[model samples]
Target chain A: MENLYDVVIIGAGPAGLAAGLYSARAKMKTLILEKDKAGGQIVTTNEVANYPGSIDDATGPSLVARMVEQAESFGAERKKDEIVKVELQDKIKVVTGEKDVYKAKVVIIATGASPRYLGVPGERELTGKGVSYCATCDADFFTDLEVYVIGGGDTAVEEAMYLTKFARKVTVVHRRDELRAAKSIREKAFNNEKMAFIWDSVVEEIKGDGIVEKLVLKNKKTGEITEIDAPEEDGTFGIFPFVGYIPKSELFKDFLETDKGGYLITDPDMKTAVPGVFAAGDIRHKSLRQVVTAVADGAIAAVQAEKYIENTFEN
Target chain B: MVILEKDNFEEEVLNSKGLVIVDFWSDGCEPCKALMPEVEALAEKYEGKVKFCKLNITKARRLAISQRVMGLPTILLYKDGAKIEEVTKDEAKAANIEAMIEKHI
Candidate 1:
């Protein structure tokens, strides 16, 4: 194959970047392809307290920037291109992007997940007006305004707490009576003075002119409908949804084995059922989806890829 | 792209006699930071035909709200001082922004 790379990693997130760094440092020709931006969902996060050994007040963009620098410094070529097709059944994997095609001995699928939407009416039109998925990005715009968060998971409750720092009041609207978040997170949310909850409810519709003005809610347990309007003076309130994530595995579904949730199924070494192909990060069916675990998966995938190449091709 | 300020916004964007794009952004916004380079590259690509400007909402909050841009990374397309179109948040990708530019230009 002409201009063949030793390894080609999809999605320049933490996992892909780490894989690039390791592979390039091992004298393997590596290329990292990203669709939109280098940083994945983590870029929308403001504080990264969970990642060990991180500097005080480390933000997501800063961490991802350092990772990119490390990867590039190790001679991994990174490009901005969205992959449209992949041929993994052959000895040399073929990856087709919107702009170009690539051939590689090893391919890493690190395309991560995106925030799932409520799919209610007007939700799409009102996005970035008064509806947001990233609290760190849009919370400051709602200062002193009432805000509603939709979801009961750790992300939802934690983001609701983050909203309390800026908004006048924060209310959680969940489909169930009890939150699915951890006990520690739920305890902090209950103790917060500005925090409130609407149990057994889901958003029916989002109403607005040019910005969010009202939200209609329906109780699942009781069939009662409630309308919440923005304050007359503020004229608008914020709605943040953190329900769940949908993995970006549509392109790989036909070629790779995936779980029920559409996440790629991989072994302990991040190898997929197909040879010369691997999956990592939140896109893979894994328990923990943190930055720490993602980078660890990337390192392991790269090392395993090296072994696979040596045994199969170098002979 | 020109760094738009409150003082020059009216002169540069409102009074400018062509297609203008103003990227409304803030400090804590990661998407805004990420989209900046792409917008700048577009600016360079359409340098002679289109005018590109960026406004930091952190500095000009009231200006941004007055224009009804209540979010970060809001890309607004204007023609002859009239606001024509806008794409925000998830829709504010490089491809979409380029399509908008191609549509207006």
Candidate 2:
């Protein structure tokens, strides 16, 4: 009973923190576990304009800090523990973390997702050396230097514009001729003085000595080859890829019902296939993954979890 | 927590007994600041079992360079003073760090 709780939410992102706010406010013995920092993907973001009623000068870190404060105010106990395993077949579920074991009547999985890599050669070796996934975190490193951005989505186009503030020029390389981003975003990128485009192409390899010096590109359609090398005077350049994200749902892969993309499958109410288990946020199978949708999922899951506890344990 | 420097890294971490975690960090890195809270909590939680130390690269560039640490917020897990595992980039989170340390202890 030392580590027992009425509800345990896994993750501390927008979804998990919102669930914690509701779960603890309902007076349930709630605990939220975040293996990494509490903010999840939002921590790496720079601008956050879509969130309704967001504060002035709202940034990813600022918004996450406010969400954490809200959850804490509701008395949700937060901990930093990496959960290694779980047991949810019985009436009471058990979770094993690196530090200790925790038991709970209901469990919410909101672990969210992370950026996906192209898995090409030298991508791993040159990361943090010149290749970066987040322009917000590493754009300053590329000041007055040339940069290459991969992907054609809204995030890619938007981040390309953001990178223009520091990089002297940013060339977006995509596998398709047209961008998949919204019209407004595409227009913004097109209008940017520093933005350039390389269509129907993908990166083959990245190379450098102690840093990123050059990139090898392949034209998918024609099978032609091209390369971009750093200026001799500069010695190195930057490459940012906003390819996409992959769900972080490996922990429950064996038990939870996931989609073809490996996102957790849940009912409209956020209840998973399991009787006492639920999933929410970007980790759950959904059409759109955004802060608003994630927060909505969190609220629903916590309410459903509260109902499950009352119906199963109290009655 | 112990402050790591070129002069004391050998005596304080290398010569020490049991598992030790040497965290390499810089001042301007946002991730390093975000992780400090959890580091304090974990060090307290594992007080008697493991030793935690930190080295600011600006202050101890020689020690950091010798380890081949190319990024900020890099964590090296040492068992009885030898490097066993290193975490950087996305893998350098609180949970992964704890799990790696648990392996050594």
Candidate 3:
């Protein structure tokens, strides 16, 4: 007989860890399955200042460590495995991973989302050397140096603002004349002292030897091309792209309800169209994709999973 | 525990009272995995009042195709055994789902 769990959570991110903590504390046989290491997107981030009630100057890795510790202390069993298939139609949901198969009465999904890249030249080659997608992670490396941010949305602007704290100068490079970020965010960007704009331009090439040293920029309006060089002494600059993110929903595309961008759908209680299966975090379509919100979703999902088990199992 | 088979989905949904939310999902979808908890929470919160269930396309591929589910994490809302609303995966949020339930309930 397969080992049965009261609740099986996918993805060991903030949401999944929170769910595990709640479910395990409730005395449920909770199992959290992660494809890779724990921490999800938070691992990629350098620091987290926005999470309410967070520790002062809490780094992303530190935050994740605390969450993992909390969940484990509550008796949430975690396994590093990738779930390859599922049988959720039955009363006992079956999840199959790369190595084993397990059964659970309830399932919680907190797989989260991944950053989308421009797929332009040198972007992939110079990822860690000078190109980065997370300002929090790479900002400190560019202390007193110049950095360029791509895109014009909320994330792009927000990251640029965050980068300004460390960088000597921060320039936002957008292909559009007007920013697509929220009004308040745009106002902040416009007001920031260290922030500069490269409007109606796109990065045609990210050129560097070992680190990012120069960028070939193309003006969208005038079709003019120019090579922006890194400041002397520093010898290199940083590039952070914040265009958008792609939700990891390809596996469930055939069955689950998804939007054009492939985000998952869930109800207030986190219920999907199917019973016993729930979703939370960045994977679900929502306005805010933050750690605090993901933790809240995990808490709600755990409580709901308990209810689902009681309703289904109790006579 | 209710054992839902392919042949009994319609009967189970129709016989149930209040609202019924169905999740159509498959394996290998990260977003589907992420949304699972929210769906479960909703089902638990409205356990008696609403029917919450998930359909795995990997197991019920024919049914999923019949329903014309083109994407993952598709949520269909049913009230009194009748289809009321359909929400795409990206639009499936607690607030949005609550609004739909409020409209029907």
Top lDDT model: 1
The alpha-carbon lDDT assigned to residue A105 of candidate 2 equals 97
Per-prediction TM-score to the true structure, in the order listed: 0.96, 0.84, 0.67
Candidate of highest TM-score? 1
DockQ for each model: 0.68, 0.21, 0.01
Q: Report the C-alpha lDDT of model 3 over A1-315, residue by residue, as the tens digit.
A: 459999999999999999999999999999999875588887656557789988898867789889999999999999877789988878999989987898999989888898898888997767755787655434556678898999999778878998898789999999999999989889999999999999999889998875688998999889999899988876778888888899987766677888789988999998878899999898998889989999999999999999999999986
Score residue A305 of candidate 3 by CA lDDT: 95
Backbone clashes in each candidate structure, one number apiece? Answer: 0, 0, 53
Q: After superposition, how far is residue A190 of candidate 3 from its true place, in Å?
A: 4.5
lDDT of 1 by residue, A159-257 (tens): 999899999999999999899998989999999999999999999999999889999999998999999999999888999999999999999998789
Displacement of the residue A88 alpha carbon in candidate 3, Å? 3.0
Query: Number of the top candidate by DockQ?
Result: 1
For residues B1-105, what per-residue lDDT tens digits would candidate 2 score against the true structure? 888888899998889888888877765355777787777788998999889999877666545645655456778888887888877777778877889888877
Which 10 successive residues of model 2 chain A have the least lDDT summed?
A134-143
Question: Could you give me the TM-score of model 1 versus the true structure?
Answer: 0.96
> Considering DockQ, where higher is better, how would the candidates rank from best to worst?
1, 2, 3
Worst 10-residue lDDT window for candidate 3 chain A reads: A133-142
Task: Point out where model 1 deviates above 4 Å.
Answer: none
* lDDT comparing candidate 2 with the true structure: 0.86
CA lDDT, candidate 3, residue A207: 89
